[model samples]
Target: MKVSIKREFDFIEYEVDMSDATLLEILHEIKTNQENSLAYSSGCRSSVCGSCAVRVNEKEVLACSYKVQDGDRVEPLKNVEIIRDLVVNMDKALETNARAKSWLAEFNKETVLNHEDEKINALQSDCILCGSCYSACPVYAVNEEFLGPFSLTGVWKYVSDKRELNAAQKIETIQTNGVWDCTLCNECTLVCPQGISSKADIEKLRMKSSMAGYSDPNFGQSFGGGFGFDGTPSF
Candidate 1:
């Protein structure tokens, strides 16, 4: 199989003997046998650890989980600093996750949730923080600080927590670069290996926002509005 890895300055192509192999396996093979300097990141070979996310044909995918094929254009995830071939600096992604306070920050220690809430949060809690959503995000292409899908999904998880005290603060934190900014394009959902639909989760957050009396920041300042043909009811 032949694949190309994006270097800082150029694309490097390699041919390996494996007919059916995972991208990670091919990467390791190339690194071990072909180029000792080849670098990539991986923790759990399974999809549980998101550390091995990269772009295959301009689409974000977990390298360990994605099957490699001929003429695959392998590259590092977008909107992140490339540390080396197919490796990116994920430290900022982790920091944003923390800054979003994706976890419960101030729930009563003794409080317990019902089974439904627990089940929902548990499904959300499977996030491996792999940053595949960040790479798949279109918002990141324009605004780097726009807390990408993973962080927003995390926010949604906690915002839905039964013991949460300040859902308002969580909503507000997500209002600007968080949920409202998402184009709802479903790109993040398509790429997530965990099968967690960050886009759908974000839409839920938007519904929660509307219930909270929050509106889009760009609500009524467009050309269509000034022309008196805006979509709003003529109240």
Candidate 2:
């Protein structure tokens, strides 16, 4: 099997006699035996920590879970600053959560746990912060200010939290580079290792925003004329 690893200046390929091995194992073998300068990130090797994320053949996947194949091209996650080899600086993508204030606001401490709220936010809470969705998100590439999928999913989680007391402010924060900025390409959902649907979470956030009396700002750009802000087509 031949594995191609993207480096700072170019791509390097290594041939190994192997089959049915995980990419992380292959990377370790390559680093230990072949190249001593290979760099990548992994933790919890069980796919729970989400640190073993990388692009296998241009598709985002968890290295711990994804099996290696013959002639596989491995690259770092896109839309992030690469520090070395497959290791990328994830701070830019993670900063969106702090900027968007996706964390839970001052909520009622005495609020009782709601099963329905737990059910609603269960999937969003499963995010391991691997940043695969952010890499797949085109909006994050073009608009750095645009909150990426994981952060948006975080916002949606807090919005649906029974203890949250500041839902209105959260809604306001996402209006600009938040939900409306998403292209709805579903790439984030496709690349998620946790099977958490950030796309669905964003959709729920949009619906929540609509309930809060907000709409997509660029809605009329498609219609140009005779269309309304409410998105109703006029004869």
The residue ranges of model 2 lying beyond 4 angstroms of the native Cα positions read 220-235
Model 1, span 53-134: residue lDDT tens: 9989988888888999899998888888888887889888778787677877778777878887689767678888888888
In order, what lDDT does every prediction score?
0.83, 0.88
Please write out the lDDT profile of model 2 over residues 146-216, one tens digit for every residue. 89899999998998897999998998888888888888999999999988888888999899888877777
Judged by lDDT, which candidate is best? 2
Deviation in Å, model 1, residue 48 alpha carbon: 1.2
Question: If scored against the real structure, what TM-score would every candidate get?
Answer: 0.90, 0.92
Clash totals, every prediction: 0, 0
Give residue 229's lDDT in candidate 1 (0 to 100): 34
Range of the 10 consecutive residues with the lowest summed lDDT in candidate 1: 226-235
